[model samples]
Target: MKKAFLASMLAAACVSATYAVAQTPVNTNNGAAAQGPQLSADEYTAYQAVITATDPAAKATAAEAFLTKFPQSSVKSTVLEQLVAGYAGSNNVPKTLESADKLLQVDPNNIRALALETSLLKAQGDSATDPAAKQSAYDKAADAASRGLKATKPAAVADADWAAIQKQVTPYFYSAIGIDALTKKDSAGAIAAYTSELKAVDVAATTQPGPVLQDTYFLGQAYYTSTPPDYLNCTYFATRTAIYAPEQFKSTFQPLATYCYKKFHGAEDGYDAVKAVAKDNLFPPADFATSVKPAPTPADQATTVFEADKKEDPTLTKTNIADREFVITNGTTEQAEAEFAPIKDKEVKLTGKVVSIADTTLTLAVSDDAKQANPLVADVSVTLTEAPKVAPVVGADVTVVGSMASYTQKPMMFTMTGGTIEGKAAAKAPAKAAPARRAPARKR
Candidate 1:
């Protein structure tokens, strides 16, 4: 992909870098391209030699000699453009970049030079060890690409030719912009720029193992990491990239797709259908977002439980400790108040893992969800009547009897007073584990 793109860039630079060289009456009284001032006879001969060189290396030398000898000539910018193209064609990396930089000094909005600068600088930024240098490279690349996008077509270039050049370089412009946004943690900006880049290229180009395909995965990551996250979009693009990736790379991309799918749909049972659909399309199909069944949000879960309750037998019962906690913690102001009304000041006995313990008060994780967090969270706090001879172990499950008191919803904790600890739940002996349950049970 690298060879092909740079080759295309060299080809474009060679053909499209031409200016009004050897025109009948070339003038540059202002040290820029103009048509009024006639070229001196000797100056015309020097310019002719530069254009007539055969080898790229020889061409570069001749162009440099012409520019140095005639620095104030009207054709300075024109000769620098040729020098940049010649170095690019010679496959000289440092020289190519140097000449392109010189060309930009003369024509700041030169599209060919900007495209080369953006691509090369971005490559350096990707592998840089110094954070400050890395950031500066991407910043400059993004700035150059931005200017390229707004560059005007010179009149000497025909409309048809300029359109073709625009098509060739526009993808780099958007890609450079996307990389800059991603480096700064601007996921929304990255998503917008990358989406435009994918649309600007041929659809087939996105399926190949190349910059476009890699950027497709980056787009999915941007969506997956965005605020509040668009899991469905993350699943779509990630699945698409996985379909085209080689076997060694397939595992890397497939896992991210599965993770996002399980996060949104709550299981992997229907994921094969998502993969099948993704294999045929670059972007998600029109109805793909709606077709995938989404798991309930926290608010939705709370609202559903509240709506389904009846006065005759409420879901917020002393026996239904986990359900009561779930609804109260996740529900809205009115819903939480309703859930808490019946349970407040009520003495309830429940078994939970001791998360933290103290002489006066300690916390416990009553619900399974809280217990499952990497570092367990306390959903229920108990104020003990007195500390025990031996303090309760941090991770041991025990039965606690306490009168429920105040609660906080956002952090989701329930405090109880005048509490006593029953003995710890028995620790399970090591044994052969049972068959693993499926995705929703995992909840991640």
Candidate 2:
């Protein structure tokens, strides 16, 4: 998962350090020459041997020998730095980390050492088996990144070279910190770090999209997981991730964007427009705003149902069972009683999908006046005249005939007695009211 992140850091470290070395002229201040204490002829010769070694393995061996022979040498930090670079060049992880630690011991603010240590620690954290060990490694990596962020350019490095190094290292530093915050469930901290990381790099121009896209996905998750979730922003960032993600990751992130957009807007109707906007912008436009379509009130829905029924059947009155159920569930008591009067004991037939079956009761989600994707609204609960030998399947369409019994508002459940399946007349017995049970909560 973190291969891209580690690869980018290794490439950047090699390129930045080598570029700086090639561009800068050799001098006493920047070279391997001893600084504070004047070196003896033998000590200077040893230092020269390490610096002039033709290969990384040879340089590492010579540097290690120099460090062991002259522990108090003025050029100890320089030798350790060479050892770090040499171990890194040879792809010797343990040796590189050991060398980097030794370099930091002598020069605590060495930018290259800090960056290397932080990147290595993050990789270790990602692969750690024990949770405690993982957290510890991530914490140390985050600490190193924090210190590296405040470190000034090394005195030996030219301004241009230092700027280039900053461009290469800054994003990875923030990425480590951001991933650490995420591991700790600090969403706000993750958001801040990832935001800074994205700002530090040209995300659109990045040759390695895996890490950047992964971070964008994590950023969206941070917004979603924050208290009082910022769903609008979540939608934007999640959608942005989908836009840039590889084929395999698109399916994972795209739905998150759609889900958040639908949740914030109360429906999926206008999500395409949001997805379109995300394709062209990393963040929402400055003038961006979503017109939230508030869910219709129960009373408003009842009124709409009443008007539509009247339009379909001009002679039909609110006393009709369906209309009565709507008004009784959504209207004031006086209006409810008035509409429920004629339908109380009258037998009526209903067609709907069997949403649930509990004992003798079958809950049917009726089509008319029922909101799409919401089963709780406009559901009819029918108490069977007899418990059928074979129960109806939950999602199958069914027709039931029953006498209207009672109703409940808010959640809008209808109770019916003397209920019988259309073709199961042989199962009929006697009418009896059943106790109402709450429907199981829907899965998100």
Candidate 3:
């Protein structure tokens, strides 16, 4: 993201003022009277021009000279604003922020000044590599945003102006807070920030549904992706979504669940499923919960997913490579083929569901234990030469024709050169269209 550039507010403001040093008022008095010379309109204009110059060093020198020459000029506010902009553009954030603070003392409701101040403080907070520094920066950014909002007259302004402020202030504030919480692993805090964003989205959705959806989608997706180990402190966000936007969740939260199941499973899947169901109406099909098993230990993860030797059962004999089940490891089928090449002519029994069948890759979920232990177990996604004639649903039992090799970085996924189905049966009964959920009525 591009850091905000200096806007033209200052340029517009500066055009109205001009002064010259030669116009300064000199006082020749007795030793008893030693007051400084008064800077007239021309002198003040000269001072302002130099301070507002584009050259960094010259601008700094001019700023100091202006304060010294006209310590109390009405042009001080404009001068300070310019100095802040010049210093900021020169990469002197501290000086820029300091000038902004001074400018704010004169014009507390100055939006441009407040913007520069907030951006500077946020940059500082973000740059602090240490925890304490980062937290402080996040807090300061939040405070600055709040102050800006209060100073702003949202009701008095036109809708477009009000919306501009909301876009600039609300989301950035929430994002700063949410990202800070994420860094600390404070799931609850992250949820709180995202919830604020959601509320803003809901309000904005009344007038602008598309933009609201786009923004809210990002916020919701962020919440879905932040699956902390054990779900440490995210129960509130899940519960709140259920209570507040059950309808919205019902429509939009399932895709997030699917993503979670694909990215992380096992204990993680439980949290993912709970959040999904709470916000939305969908549940993981019972069979899906039984598939993608997770291992209790690292060693179990290594051995359980890839068993070495096995004889095909006559009762459970599969038709071809595509009919048997298999999961993709980090490695490729060509490597697996080479490893299992000697046994290429040999037949092996594999059972799994076609997790996905795309034009290029075919992923399958194989082991029942893996499916159950980790509902989001990694599946075998192989490059296919041609699109498969069959399409696989999320939860379906199928058989495939393929051979396994010693697992590489990629799992030893079976490449479905071709195959036929051979499964006991699907655990799911069926899917039927259902009515939308509604909240109960309240008593008078």
Candidate 4:
């Protein structure tokens, strides 16, 4: 969850010639009229002294002094910009922010100022513990980023430098907006912002793995958490992230990618194909299409099991509980009769969890190979010889000895008669009710 940092870009750009103050040609007409702010001899001397300082600390000191003396100077913006650069170079975050704000007051569209402010605000928002404060900071950061995105290149900046600045700051701007949207639980908004960010940058060409990879992961998460989750896109982006993620992150993102792919495809059959596609592409192919197949029905699964088991033992169809249950519940009428024929009038010992009781009939979910079938599909209906002394509680384990009387297949039930609870425990006392407290007296 580490947020991207653009402080280095801000610091470098501000001090470099890209953001240097515009220098006007010196006029030798000292005794004549001046075109712009004609600085006095001392003021001009101080300006030169500030700009020519060797180190950032000395530059900051000189710039502050110049600004203190010439508060209304025409070059105030220039001095403040220098101070911003100086403070940033010194790693003085508070003063750097303060200087950037001062520069913004004079030149609101200043790219360096806007970039620094937006990045700092986002960093603060990321670390904030209070939800309201965090949202407010992120909201402000996103606003600044929006304005920065529209900012025109400065007159003094070269075309190449401006392009480089754009390439660096634009992604961070979009990321701020997307992260804020994610915090607000606006998954669609986050996806839109992140998509715009990826389109703005060549993520596959990025040499650094931090920002682009992380944003790609976030984009996948946004898709996953959408109203109706876009599992296909989620799988694509998540797999792409895994392709570029660090070794530690590979293990983390791989499972998410696999799960989404499996959920969308209904099986793992084509997962290797998806991963191969993701390794070379940032987005899904234009011709991409996939369909989710429904899981097999219980009856279909039972038939599959029966067929597989019959390969080993031909007599399994008549003796296996699963095979018999499948035939009785899901097979044709003739098949049900064939399976039920041999067991008629035979005494069987059944062990299962009690599902429900009505008068003398107990519905049970018969267990097979130690695993019980779902209680809702109760397969045993035992008719007791007589009403017992105590009624058995639902979900209690019990053994019944009864003769198989009959069965119905559509709503499958196996009727047994002459049944009795082989062993029953004494019923425990009901839990005592907690004492209620008196209401507190109303204040006078």
Best candidate, TM-score: 1
List, residue by residue over 112-167, the lDDT tens digit for candidate 2: 78888788787778777789998998898899999899999777678998898788
- Full candidate order by TM-score, most accurate first: 1, 2, 4, 3
Would you estimate the TM-scores of all the predictions? 0.81, 0.66, 0.38, 0.64
- For candidate 2, the per-residue lDDT at 334 reads 60
Q: Which stretches of candidate 3 lie over 4 Å from their true place?
A: 1-39, 47-52, 153-166, 180-189, 195-259, 262-444
The local distance difference test score of model 2 is: 0.72
Off by over 4 Å in 2: 2-37, 154-156, 206-208, 266-272, 291-444
Cα lDDT tens digits for candidate 4, 1-444: 333334323323333323344444232326557665567777888888777886888889999999999999877888888887777767676787788889888999987777777777777677677899989988988888888999998886889988988886777788788888988889999999889888888755432466667778789989988988887888888888888877876888788888777666656776777777778777777766543343344455545545554565554534555457665666667657766776788887776667888888898876342224443447789999987788788767677889989998867778999998887832432232232111111100
Tens-place lDDT digits, model 3, residues 1-444: 111111112212221121111112333333445354444656646664665476765776687677677678755665666666666656666676787788788878656556555555655564566779867876776566556656765243567865665565554455445555655666667667755755554443422223223324334445554654322112323332333443644345344444443343434445545554434422223554344443234333322222331223232222133212221221145433333444344444455655666664656666443344445353444444455565556556555544433333343344444343444335553232232111111110
lDDT, model 3, position 249: 49
Candidate 4 clashing pairs?
none
Worst lDDT run of 10 residues, candidate 3, spans 435-444
Error of 2 at 110 (Å): 1.6
| TM-score, cand. 1 | 0.81
